[model samples]
Structures are given as structure tokens and as C-alpha cells.
Target chain A: MAQVILKRIASGDKSAVQDCLKTYGGLIWSLARRMSPNPEEAEDAVQEIFIDIWKNAARFDETQASETTFVAMIARRRLIDRLRKINRQPNVDSLEDVLVEPTNDREQDLQVCVEAREAAAAMKNLRPEQRQILHLSIIQGFSHQEIADALKMPLGTVKTHARRGLIQVREFLGLGSDFEKEATV
Target chain B: MKDLQDNRLVELLADQSFFGLSAEEGMELGQLKKRFPEWENDFSLELTAAAIGLANLDVREDLPANLRAQVYANADEFFSEGATDQEVFNFAPSANKTIVSPPGASVAETTSGFSFWQNLGWAFAAVAGIALAVNIWTTRFEKPSEVVKNPETIQMPKPELTTAQKRDELLASAKDAVQISLTNPKNEKEIVGDMVWSNEKQRGYARFRGLPANDAAKETYQVWIVDETQDSKTPISGGVFDVDGSGEIIVPINAQLAVKKPKAVAITKEKVGGVVVSKQENVVAIAKV
Candidate 1:
């Protein structure tokens, strides 16, 4: 098994610090810049996110997720918290512009984890509106209201689409075991 | 695990992972979380979001070289095993400034910032110690300074010091100052910040990074200093403040009553203009001194 950088970090391995930074730094930096309103905020968010990562290094469970996924989870939570705190949505492309573009034709340079690839495939299986709503909410960071206004759908409808679409996606990603296990019990 | 079993919880969790939740929804989710203790973490859906976000990230930009260097330096200090309590709190003695410890305080009391990490569910509390002298000094020293025309003094452009800079200055000037990190005691783990208090100066400041901005008309954050000299049930009101923007915010602590010995500092969400005394509910963060 590959040594988890976070576990190494938890053990006070100074060398894992560099490895962790090198591995997830770009991913976090990109997420921050995309989610933040400005470059300076992005930089600050990056620092705070790194601090959170370091603090949470001991909590990383390899049985639950890959290191990249765990790091991404932390980064996303931090970014969302930041957005909620700042009362700002991600400075992403307009809904119209993004809707016109092919969502799958993203930059290939960034590494995609297995879950994300499966998520992408699952997204394709969603209804058009559901896919679009999920895309707007997850990728573009649009609030339900914002998505409703953009898509000219009712707010409740947008939320339903988002929730239902997400449930489907989660199930497709093999994350529906919670429900399955509970049902059997 | 029970989240998926309950449709409402699933909906809330899904909303949380996607574009986030409304204040009402968040409260509901938090309430629901109490019913399901096995819900160890809320980042499961966020993990899915991460995968999608990673798959679709427009560009993979490299971490700035300067940021990389800063991270390494901080990590070195943070992970250093031999660092003292002061160093852990980032309060090294300045070259020109003399170090003076706060009276009747020990190293253990001042260095409780790291305890937040070790102990989960530890409620954050604010500063303490109600000094009667602070009240007398304020009342007796109400004199306006007469402007003396000094042409010899160079009127340099004085750059406004940031809240962070002011915090550093307070730490440097007040040798007896205490700094503590604050965190949320609830399901939301993103809220984290620090409080710096100086009993001698009777002045303090709270700095927060992830505290949500509030609508001034609807709600505001009120700070409270739990003075050991006073009743544990009733803390000294540290005035009300608002977070207007993102990133680090520094709010000066405005203690209504003189604080002599603060055992903990707390911030609670109150109605507009704040209340005379908080019901000890809706507390956002607290730093146990």
C-alpha cells in the first residue's frame, strides 16, 4: 500500500509536508481561485485551507477515501464555508456561456480521480435539466435560487432536481450503501 | 450512515454538498444531525463534489513559488517538536520590545490554543479578569490633546495598520496578553479563529477567518468575556460586531464592564443591536483562556 502523506504528516514526518503540498497544492490553489472572488482572497483561502489540511491530517482515513479525494473533500468544505461566510458565489462563467459549452471537454491536464470519472459518467445518465442543474450547482457553484433564476425554473423544482440528481449520482458512485445497509438492517 | 435512510437528511446533505444550504436548511440539518450520531462527518457528499470539481477544473495552475515557500516555513515551525508555548502561538519576543508576562498567569494557561485540536466538542470561550482600575482610568483620563504645531516633526504618510498588524502590535506592547484559537463546537467545522486579549491595556481583539457575514439589520455577533472574578453564569459583554466581508476579519473587543480575569471568551449570534445579556445560546465561537 502506498504511504498516505496525511498519515505521514500525522506522525510528524516533516518530509510528508512537502509531498502533501506538492501533491494537493495545485488542486487546492485552483479550487480557491475558482471559488474566491479575487486573487488575494484566493491566496488567503489557500493558506487557510492548507492550515485546515495540516490540522486535519490526523483524521485522514485511507479506508474511507484516497488521499487526493480526502484532500479535495477538505478543500471543497473550506471553499464552501468561505463562500457562505463571504456571501458570494464563485466567480464562474455565466450560466448561459457554460450551458453552451461542452461540460466534458474540460482541461485534461488536471488529474481526475476514479470517483470523479464515475461521477461524470453518472451525470451523463441524468435528465438534461437535472444534469444542467447539477452542473450549475456543483461545478459553477450556483445557489438554488441562482440556478432557478438562470434556468427559469421554480426554486423548488431546481432544488428537487439538484437533490434527486445528486442522489442518483451518489448511488452511481457506489455511495448509496448507507441506504442499502440500513434497509437490510 | 443514517443520513441516507432519512430522505430529509439526504436532501439536506445533498444540498450541503452542492451549492450549500440556506440558513434555515443549515439549522434543520444541524438539528437532524443530533438524531443521527453515526453521521461521523458531513464531507461525504463534498467528496463527490470534489471528484466532480477535480474532473472539471478548467486549468491546473501550479502553486505560486512564494506560497510554496511560505507553506514550508510555516510547516517547519508548526511541526517543530521543540517549539515553546509562545512560539506555538506565534508570539516570539520582538528584537526591540521587552517581554513582560501577564501577572498571575502560567505557561499552561497561555498555551491552551493547541487543546482545541486535541479535544473535540470543547466549547470556545473568551477572555476574563474584570479590573476595576480599567474603569477608573477611562473615567479620569478624558482629556483632549491640544494640537502642538511642530514643524520639525516630519508628517510622514502613516499607513493604516491592518487588523492583523494591530493584533501583532497589541501582542508586542502588552506583555501580559493572551492569545487563544476559537473553533465551532457544532457540525460545521469550518469556523476557526483566534482571540487576543490584554488585561493590562483593558483592550482585546478577535480575529476570525470563516465566520459568516451577517446582515446588520437582522443579526450581529456579540462577544462576551467570562471573567473568573465574576459569576460563571453571567459574562461581561464584549459589545456587538458584524462581519461584512470574506477573509480574515479583526473585531476590536469592546468590553462593557472592566475585565479582571477572563477564563474564556465567547461570541454569540444575537438580534440587531445585541442584547444586554445573551441566554448563553447561539454561541458561534469561544476561546477558553
Candidate 2:
């Protein structure tokens, strides 16, 4: 019901920058801290990410994705690029280390909150191994080899679980079949 | 109508939305979209599903107030310079320190009230000053021999070549190596690559030109060494790697087990690390030996 912060920033309102920081600074900082290897690097990355966000503000399409999702997408792109540049290897952590069962207390858009809740609920239905693979892939940003090393599972088994887990999650969200028809509009 | 091909397409879409689509898969996806527009919807849904999955991970911690102030100041400075917002990205922390300005100033009324000649002279002076400063800084702080002797002092190390470089080196030195083309059956010419291996050396390299850079977090392309002489049907694991960029990637063959009589080398899209045995459902390219 309110004008999106990105739209205001795109219109060259300097005050919107403050408003955006108040709203999403924590979200971006948390993500940067998680992705960056060190605090200084994280601080620098956060600065660059805000600059990127400013430049890309005009391109945000709320119809396609929520504001938080859009911001997350941009943040990940920058953070991942930094990660690749440094060739920093992440420690392989077992699935138990990463997966946090979603709680309903957080404040977010209703639709977004619903989707997150659905994904969390669906995760409960998955086999422990499948859930582990999904968590590593989705949350921790580990490659399959890292997962194999961390879990001591066969590489083939990891792929099987990843493929099956994603498919099952999609189904559980009621998006497996007839998903195309719902998405295009 | 929706069979194995549909399932494969769905898997490819999933990979594309979560990580990235390989160039070969991208081509296949493009064709599928053109032929079957409904596939676009499927792709969109998959992307949404990935975003939703990510939403569960959102746990926020407030940014330090100083960092927020820094961001606000940077943005204000960037906007106040009368330069377009996008130009702010051109300011690198290291290297040239020129503040970029908008082009096309009237010759008669240059800002700062400096005439053309004065501005030109000042620019030359600035360049000379910068050069002298750099020389002094480098000589005083970083002696070349000392830096070489004690590399740890450098805050940021130079980027090393990725695994692709190692693969390229292996291919370059391989003896008696044969080159074979990897082709897809559906779109044979569109998605193709070359694999060079030396049977005697028991080593090889795969050079794929069109594979998209994969998101290391989601999926990776796995190489398989098809050895028929081993008395087993399972292809030897040739290690796992992800494409970092679009264009030819030369990856060294890392065979888990020894390769006896070589039949062929195949590549399949697998989960990030790779799989022990491939189901072969998403074989992007195959180079027969």
C-alpha cells in the first residue's frame, strides 16, 4: 500500500537512503557478515552493496519478487563475486550446523512469510539427509564437494538427495504441477 | 507429452534458477521456451521457489550505526557531485583518484573559474604530483626484494588461476593425446566441446567453450571417465568442477581410480560436488574416445 523505497531512491530522494538503511540495513549486514570472511571485508562489501543497490534501484520489479527477495538477490550477487575473486574456501559444516527450523516470530510480508513457513514445514517432511543437502545448498552456500567432505557421504548420493529434495519441496509448496500457469500471470 | 524430456527440462530449470544454467543447457532452455512458451512459467516458478527457500534463512542483526552513517555519507557525496549515480561505481579504492565529472562544459565559463590553459596546467601538475607520491610510497613502504622475501605483509594477495588453469596446463603437456568432440543429441551443434586425453599418460583435459558459470553453491558439472576394460560398468570419477565463466574452460582430468582401456569421456550436470555414479539424465556433452 506504500510507495516502495527503491522507487523513491530511483527518483533521487536522498532521504530515502536513510529510510532504506533503517528498514534493510540489518538484513544486508547480516548477509554480508555471513558471506564475508572477515569484519573489515564485510564492512567494505556492505558499502559496495549499497552503491550497487542505488545503481540498480530503477530495475526493481515488485510484481516479479518481493523487495526483500530483490535485495537478497543483489546482495548475493555482489558477495559471491567477492568470494570468487578472493578464492576463499568455506569450511565444510555438517547439515546440523546450518539448518535452523524456521520460526514464525519474524516480521516480513505476509506472502513472503507464508512461503518461508511453507518451505520450513516442507523441510520437516524430507529425510534427514535430504534436508541437510538442501540446507547446505540453500542457506550455507556450500558446493556439493564441500557437503560430501563435511558429511562423508558419497558424491553420487549428494546429487540424488539434492535433486530429489528440491523436487519434493516444490511439490510440497503446491508448485510442482500446473506451476507454469500460476507463475506467468 | 511430459516424459523424461520434461523431467530433464525441469531439472535444468531448477539448476538455472538456483545456481546457473550451463551454456549448453541455456541453449536447450532457449529452444524449449521458443517452442513451448509454458516452460517460461515453469522457470519462473522454480525461481520463486528458490527465493522462498532463501527466505527461511533470514535472521537479521542490526548494522553497526557507524556503518550506516558511512553508507549515508557515501550516497550523499555521490549524489551531490552532480554525477549520475551509476558513475559512483567507477571510484575504485586503489589506483587513479580522479573524481569523474559530467562531460560538456561551456568553454567560456568553466567551473572553479579556471581558464582552459590553467586547468590543463593544473591537471599536468596533479599527474606529476601523483607520480612522485606513488614513487615515494612504493620505495619507502614496499621494497621489491623485501616483499618477495616476506609476502605475508601484503594485505591482499594476487588472485591465482583457478582449477581451469591447471586443467589447461595438463592438456598442454599431455603426450599422445587425442582430441574428441562432445556433442548433445538434441541440439548437436549448439552445445559441443572437445576432450583431449593421453591413454599412455592416463591423464586428460576437457575444454568446453559454451558452458555458463555455475553457482558453486547449487550445481556443478561432473566429468566421467568411461573405462570399459575395468570389468565394471561404472565410469571412473574424473573429479568435479564448476564453470566460472562463459567460454572455453580447460579442466584437468582428476580420475579417482585408474583408467584402463578408455572408451570415452562424458560430462553430466550434477549437484555441486558431483556424483559417484551419474544417472546420465542431464548429459550436456559427450566426447567418445
Candidate 3:
């Protein structure tokens, strides 16, 4: 698929960009939105993602991953990188929620709810602290020691939580044990 | 590497923030991965890990048209002018550019020849255009200012928005629900979102913070208000407006008129196409408003 896009792009296929947007806009938007500080930022990130996609269309490798995933990953990374300059706040209790204007886009709402529920259920397996730690360290990607110092816990405790937390997550999904099995160097 | 029993390393792989790990941290994680092979290659966990960070957050798909044009204009100027593979996105210097121009293509088309690059260019261009369009489509057409040049040429109303205008603004802003979290404990640093339910302000707004910086060009969070007033089923729109993106801004909410409290308040990721129904994800931050 990427090869087709690459070939087509190489051939000056004008419609290819829209096709890519049609195909992966949602995925890229999702990934970019995660790292966006706010809606406008996310919107801007989407624009950048597409720009980067077009600029790099010649380099897409279909063999490496799905084109959707590839572009989405690129978008995801760009968003994350953009996020780095800003202070990595743990989570701001949404301040303006009290007055948020209601929208009428129901289907989109339902879709987001469905996906959010799935993601939330996966998160439910995590203990509140585990979830927080994971949110800070993994999702937000903080160092263990860094997390340890922030949370003011022993380094060992942080490690224990991460390991046991991961093990528990594996169990929550009802998978085999030994989730942290050794890797081949 | 075998004895890399550092359990802390295992935590890094599970972190969505693993992309920014330092070299020492990376080495440490790599060692742990050698000891725990599954850590580096857990697809299911990675999916969940990735999605979890994104959960409860909105992705904006609306691109203003002008921004799209600006990017395209720039691309044409810089990238199009260079016949080299510089447009090719190879992080490494040695990567070759792919040229897939269809047969019988003229050299004039060399700039956007790759059928896919053209698509790629259009996609970006689409976002820029959307941004411009959004800016234009958004502003209510007010009467243009008159009087050539007197200091007071224009009659400035003491108050810009009349009561009716204010109501209209509110109605417009009420068109979409801004995701918010009134219940979250203050001072918490997580990016908690909730629904914004109001009809006396702009047509759109969101109460959000803690998100990392990223381009939000064609992207905008939309409000979805479900109305069960007249009918037992089906929720309708209030209105739609792009997020101010400076923390939060008022947007019109759209739901059954006169219904202060709609059945449900929700948000969706809308497209530059501005569809009545969004074919995208919603953070699903449920709210009583």
C-alpha cells in the first residue's frame, strides 16, 4: 500500500494526498491530539503531520509497517516532541469543563465514547497509584528514578510497582504469566 | 545484559513517554530488555499503552484553509524548487528518494510527480486551506465599517454584543460541548477533560490543559449535544466552532433550543469536511451538563 502511494506520489499523483488524509486522518489526528496541549495545538499538529507526510512520502516503507501506522507513528512522534518543551504537568483538573459548550455531533461522540470505554477498561486494571505512576512514567514517559524522586518513594518501590503493575496488567488481560521475560540481546 | 534485573527498566517500555528516554536510560532499558525480551516487543501492551495516553482526549480534524495554502506555498517554493530528494523524509542521509511519476508525465510535473506525494501535498494543503476557511467560515459577516478616515468614522456601539447578539453568541457557542472535568480535584496535573454546557457565549469552547504542544491546524474539538426533548431518541447539534486553543474559549452549543439540560453532552473529532456526523473518535468525557 505504501509502495503504491510511493509509486503514485513519485508519478505526481495529485489525488494521493487527499487519499492519505481520507485513509489515515483519524489515526493521525488521534495520535497528534494526545500530545497536543489543546485543541488548536492538536489541529496545528495535524496540519504539520500531513505536511511532514507529503514531504516524506517518498520515504515510506510499506514493508516496515502499515502505512496508516507508519504515518500515524510519525504524527505521534511529532506531537510528543512538540510536547517536550512545555512543562510535563501530571494532569490538570480540566478548569473550563464547567462551562464547556455542548456540541451536536452525536455519532462522533458515540465513537469516542466507545473507544474511550475500551481504553478506560484497560486502564481500570491499574490501581489508582499504579495508573498514576504509569500515566506519569510510561504514558508520560518519566524515568523511574525521576518518578521515584517526584513521588518521593524508594527507587525499589517504584521498580516494584512498575514490574508488578505490568505483571498485573498482563494478568488483567488474562494472558500468560512471565510478562517480563528476558529479551535476547 | 543478562543480569539486567533492573525492574525499573521494565517500567520504561510500558511508558508512553518512552520515546524521550535518555541515552543512559535507553542503555539501561536495553539491558533490561535483553533480560526480559517481552518488554521491548509487547504489541498488545504497546497498543493499550499508546491508546491509554490518548484516552479522554479530543483530536481536532478541522484544518483552516489558509494554513493549508501557506504550507503548500512554502513547499512549492522550497521543496518544489529543489529537484533533489530533500523532500524525501529520510532521517538518515543515505536514504534514496522514490520517484513514482506515472508514464508520460512531463518534467514540469517533477515537483509533485510521485502520485503519492501529490496526495501528500494535497492533504497538507487541505489542512492549510481548512484553517483559512475556518477563520473565514467562523466570523459572522458583520456590516463593513463605513466613513473614509475620520477618527470616529465608525459609530462604535457602547457595547459590541447586544442582548440578542449575546444570546446568538451563546447559542452559537452552545453548538458544541467542550469536554471538561468539574469533579477532578484541583491541582491534579493530569490532562482531565469535561463537557462545556452553555448557550450564552461563543459557539465552541473547551476547558483543557496539560497537553504537550503540537500543531492543531486542521484539528478542532467539537461538541455533541443529545436531545430527547421532542423525540424519545436522537440528539441534535447546537453549533460548531474551532477551539480557541488558548486553554479554553467559548463556542456555541447546539441542541434542542430551550432545553437547558440536554440528554447528554459529548464531543467528537470533526473533519475539515465539517460533516454533520463525525467519522472519528471522541474522548468520551461524559458530563451532566
User: Alpha-carbon error at B38 in model 1, in Å?
Assistant: 2.9
| Best DockQ among the predictions, by candidate number | 1
lDDT digits (tens) for residues B1-289 of candidate 3 = 4344644654565443334455676687777768767555444334334444444433334332333333333333323344545343211111101111113422223243444554464454344443332232112112233233332322221222332454444445555534445222333343345444553222333444432222345654555555544232223434344544456333334331234345565555454313333333543233444
Give the per-residue lDDT of model 1 (tens digit) for B93-122.
110001111233222121224343322211
lDDT of 1 at B244: 89
Per-model TM against the reference? 0.54, 0.45, 0.43
lDDT of 2 by residue, B115-143 (tens): 35434433553555433423322232345
| Candidate 3 structure, TM-score to reference | 0.43
DockQ of each: 0.18, 0.12, 0.13
> Please, what is the whole-model Cα lDDT of each candidate in the order they appear?
0.63, 0.59, 0.43
Q: i-RMS, every candidate?
A: 15.9, 13.4, 12.6
Highest TM-score among the candidates is held by which one? 1
Candidate 3 runs further than 4 Å off: A1-14, A26-34, A38-44, A51-70, A89-132, A135-181, B3-19, B23-48, B54-61, B70-81, B84-289
Residues A78-173 of candidate 3: C-alpha lDDT, one tens digit per residue: 565565544333312222211122232332342233333354455567776666666555443445655666667787787667655655554454
Q: Give all candidate RMSDs, comma-separated.
A: 20.0, 18.1, 16.6
